[model samples]
Target chain A: MSAATPPSAVGPPAPGDAGVLVIDCVLVTEILTGFVREEVGKVGFRRGVVGLSGGVDSALTLAIACRALGAENVVPIVMPYRTSSPASERDARRVAAQLGADPLVIDISAQVDAYFERLPDADRARRGNKMARERMSILYDVSSARHALVIGTSNKTELLLGYSTIHGDSAYALNPIGDLYKTQVYALAGHLGLPEEVLAKAPSADLWEGQSDEEELGFSYALVDRLLFHMVDERRGRDELLRLGFDGGFVDQVARRVRDSQFKRRPPLIAKLSQRTIDRDFRYPRDWGR
Target chain B: MLSDPDVLAELAGEARPDPVVALAQGAPRLGDVPANVDRHLELIAQAAERGADLVVFPELSLTGYFLKDLVADSAVRLEGKEISALARASRAVDCVVGCILEGDDHRLHNAAVYLSRGEVVHVHRKVYLPTYGLFDEARYLAAGDRFRAFTMPLPSARAHREWRAGILICEDLWHPTSPAVLARDGVDVVICPSASPGRGVGSGAELGTAQSYDVMTRTYAQLLTTYVVYCNRVGYEDGVGFWGGSRVVGPDGEIRGEPASREEAMPLHRLERGALRRARIANPMLRDERHDVVDAEMRRLRRRSRM
Candidate 1:
């Protein structure tokens, strides 16, 4: 190769638990940024918006979005609940500030508390669902106000685990980081020059006071990344995973979650009452250019 | 596992020559010969910096695709300025470019010229002009009557090796013999420069034009036991969207690297010539092909089916 490999202008390799699926981050980022620009431009859209959750996934998406649509065009709205960590908000603010993005900070505490006040019998699960929906509601309102399409921040590992709220956090017009695994998100976050604090912090949904993602999922992102990379992408069967030093119980659990939550990854299935079913025959893209 | 340099040298000599080839997947404006030629030179230098031994562009890339009456203005003679600049750029890397070449008979042919070693080496004009559907090539440009492989210099880090290769314009490789004839001539590499547009709604089974091309190019590689360097342009020119799915497939009939998208890109791929030798030795399909019998039968059928 000429020029002594060009000084790795593509960036260094991000560490991963699974040796498989080590992406070419430079090429991937370029192609993905180009994709976002092309798809958005095809529909005559010059602006975009994303819900900034202070998590690595959203941080990575925002970075790519900023590159694609420019910081001025990308509106990162941070909607924090009362119980949401101060560090998370600080990180989100830092991300917006670093990108020169004027973020809209809308606290959803009053909205969530008001809804919970009426449903006094609502448990933590019910409250969490409501909070997720409330945040989305604010995001949509902001999107309308700014004439921007909402970008999603759900990761592939989380989607597989059904860790996100349906019709709330899962709803989006377009998503860039959804294809990456949770661990891959961290790697890309590092490459994109996200704050060290954001990368170092334990990932959480921030629905409660101290709810870490690993605790809820009963496995680490590194472990799940390795398992899912082999299971989903590599198409490794149960025996193969076991042969590759994976516990049988862990494999069974991950496999069951991925299989059961397949519905969350797709649109609502409509019955084929007509020739062009809503989710079938009449299905199309976002109509960027017909 | 002895560390013998002589054994390593012998093995390396037999290994595949994985030379880098860059695909210039940018759209050229209609009849913009000078600018397009300049762009080609820039891409050639960039490809050379990226270690590319050869760089290819789309069909009639000097002009735009879907040329109606603009080909006359776009056509250039062999000694034209555009060819001369490209020939100078060839000092950095080999160049295969599609153009409307002005023929000796004073006609314009949809042509692909092979430029290497600061000279215009060979020109393979388009053998087939698609007149149906969206294409109207037969109405304006002269069709190439010949199809043959030429010996071109294959640049390597150590030394230059002579390689038998062929070039097929957009619609030429659709026919079976376009690739078979080259394989019969023992060509190792065949470059296909296309301006195919993206079409159809992506379904569960396919991705429209990309999927259709995948089957065709991969089948050609496997059948001929040869490497197929397929470079298709991206970006819309006059409402027609070109799906940039440029790829370099080895004799194993698989994509060697990530393909380009619907963007103006110059994706570099290192194609291994060793894969051809490996595939041929493994299948022996080319060795076992009875070209004489097939040729004789085709002639007999042609002679008998006369009106």
Candidate 2:
């Protein structure tokens, strides 16, 4: 490399001398679906299944999979809990209708209640996690029974914050929206021209009645994302942030959420006393040993 | 990939075209940051005034990198009221420093503000994050997944001279996908803002730090057939010493200009635009791309047991 002068010396071209490099995200996504299609063919599999909850993320996932693998290749599972809203069920069926995928309406309320009856000492978080795990178990079982891989529905935002239930919603053979933010998801949904009902509804896990994502987090995705942007993207300091015109209370809150969620972002910690740990000591890609 | 000989012959044959580059280097830290960002900006502005077309800064140029707690406080909403000062500055000097952009996505990103023709043209976020080592990027950032490209005024203010440029945050340049994507999309030059750590690398060590990085740069510049202006940060931050050895490697595996290692000096390089067109004509890697090779996900799935 030349060492005499840095490249920052060059001046920008005058007005009208620059060419724009716009990314057609929609087209890229279509290309992604094409890749998924080719992947399914390469695997010699014609069928796939999706656990659709009528949420925008899942609906979009199911829709994309349907386009890539076809309606016959995709399955939509709506496993409603006791508190699952009717709107959620309707949304799931609506998405299935739009995508032409058959809907499997399996109300797991009774089964979840049975488990709770056996173990009355379970806490809310535990119960919620159990519900999530139960959904995954059903999806995987159907996957095995149908000889198909379960397509993951979690988006990038959930992945970053560890907002997903591990071994439950997070376990998947493949994921499409793993790189997009919640905000970007909305944009993509618009590009896909999805049903307005799914796009307009407030985001929710539908684990419990009226449980919204923003309410539980005690902050909006907008504010949390901004705070995260400052901390994560810009690599700014906490004190300098206050000088930049953000509320101290909000900054501290977002920082705490990001800090507390670190455990979720990593592989489960194994005591280093043992020689071999999963990600750290025994490092390999997912396909290793196979 | 085209051989170096093939690239050099083509570049040598092309008419000597004036070089224009848009730079993106390390920016100032928010609070308690070393006084290099402002000083560097001043140096870059002066260099630009001396007929340099574009002067780029690193991600978060006005602030330090990885200010985890300081983002909310130091974040600048590019479209909001905070960018007024930057807009004014860009208009005054006709240069854009890659600014720490507080995006309306409600996310703070290590973004580059392309100030050209007296306006902020576009902003690019750092796509790849270095989560390992002393970096805890995943803790604070939402990774950028899109490969949106931007066109800026060629660093030469010459009328009728247009150039396509792309901005990649530090870690993004390390990955082949970034340059590949940009080059395939038809960018003339790729600017990288690197905050690489400086250290005493043992001579002849297994990982031989000195020779390794320049090799990486040469390989990429030649492979992509695009001008590469790598502006690395100098000095240290939080025990990490930045080795400032910024350089511009031509598309044909030769150095046009190299800055002193870890020096707080702003040296300028003159690049010939004709060199790029000539290099591309000789070895058109962009025209010969097979996107099938870019998939890490599908490969992982296939390698796993089908059972």
lDDT of 1: 0.79
Model 2 chain B: worst 10 consecutive residues (lDDT sum): B199-208
lDDT of each: 0.79, 0.66
Number of the top lDDT candidate: 1
Q: Give one digit per residue, the lDDT tens place, for model 1 in B96-203.
A: 988888967879999889998889989998989899776778988888888888877745433334567898887887898899988888888889999996643312
Predicted candidate 2 versus true structure: per-residue lDDT over A1-290, tens digit per residue: 12222222122321332211112454435544754554454455777788999889998788788888888889789999978899999988998998888988888888789889989998877888889999999999898888877888887667767788878899877777765567656766777877899999999988888889988876666545544555665587976555444567777766776677777656676777677666655533232111
Predicted structure with the largest DockQ when compared to the true one: 1
- Root-mean-square deviation of candidate 2: 23.8
Q: Give me the TM-scores for chain A across all models, comma-separated.
A: 0.91, 0.80
- lDDT for B251 (candidate 2): 90
- Interface DockQ of each model: 0.02, 0.01
Lowest lDDT 10-residue stretch of candidate 1 chain B:
B198-207
DockQ metric, candidate 1: 0.02
Give the lDDT of residue B249 in candidate 1: 83
